[model samples]
Target: MSDAEVWTFNVDDYAAKLQCPTLIIHGERSDGFEAAAQHVFRKVPAQNKKLIIVDGVFHTRFYDDPLVIEPTATEVAKWFKDNVK
Candidate 1:
């Protein structure tokens, strides 16, 4: 968890190195999250990568809210179906 802190380290290098089918899902209302998510989405090298913006939700809430999580789960499942063998 300590290694994941943005203040301590950066992932842009790793983001640029991604070679797998990537799925980027984030909520619509986060203050600075959308831009960061888009930045990572742009860096992914995978041809089959996707960026999904979930509606009526915000960053942390997307993880816990049933209303938001269910639909987001559907999108995740679809991404796996289309990208995974």
Candidate 2:
């Protein structure tokens, strides 16, 4: 089995079982999470689903964005405040 296979199994069994609204945020410059996040979003069935791809950001931008980390932080905060129960 390869990394892809292992991740596929986990996503299929566990990630797919989430039963609530979901918000997926990714960076345009990210490589690691770009595909995984999309795959999870496609597999998981949610009432309200949102996929936010921040332009000009890398994989680590979530932690330390260049232009403005505060904007990303604010977006996530707002999303959770509005969506999560």
Candidate 3:
């Protein structure tokens, strides 16, 4: 098995053990790691689950694009407010 395959397996297993509320934000242009994000998001059993797909955003755009970052932060804040105590 390759290193990437091993990493994927470990990440999926880790995600399956998460029980807290989860907010998954994915860059639509990031084809590389989107499947991993989706696997993690689906594993989380949150009453309030959020998956925000920022269009036209690349993998690293979250650090550079205000347009994507702002909305992601807003949604995450809302998810926390709605779920967390």
Candidate 4:
């Protein structure tokens, strides 16, 4: 099998082992793995985990659009500040 195919194993077991704070960000309009992201979020054992779904944005917009990136950046910065220390 290809390397990517070989890596396509179940990660729920690995996610359950996470002990550090985790922040999961998804786009509300994303046609990607948003549902899978939610599924993993439910399985994560971290007490300091957070999930944020940005409204009115699609996947990949967060990297280029200022309207999307601004708020997303704010949320990420706040999350790091609140959780990392």
- Using all chains and alpha carbons, the TM-scores for the candidates as numbered come to 0.87, 0.72, 0.73, 0.83
Clash pairs, model 2 backbone: none
Clashing pairs in 1: none
Error of 4 at 57 (Å): 1.3
Candidates 2 and 3, the one with greater TM-score: 3
- lDDT per residue for candidate 2 within 1-85, as digits (tens), equals 8988876666656657777877788887786677777887788777688888888788776776546578877887999999887
Q: What C-alpha lDDT, on a 0 to 100 scale, does residue 80 get in candidate 2?
A: 91
Compare candidates 1 and 2 on lDDT and give the better one: 1
Whole-model lDDT, model 1: 0.84
Greater-lDDT candidate between 3 and 4: 4
- Model 3 CA lDDT for position 57: 81
lDDT of model 1, residue 26: 82
Query: Model 3 over residues 1-85: C-alpha lDDT tens digits?
Result: 8988876766666667667767778887897777767777887765557777777788888898788778878888887888889
- Which 10-residue window of candidate 1 scores lowest in summed lDDT? 1-10
TM-score of 3: 0.73
1-85: candidate 4 lDDT, tens digit per residue: 6889669967798789998999989987898677888999999999999989887779899889998899899999999998998
Local distance difference test scores for all models: 0.84, 0.77, 0.77, 0.88
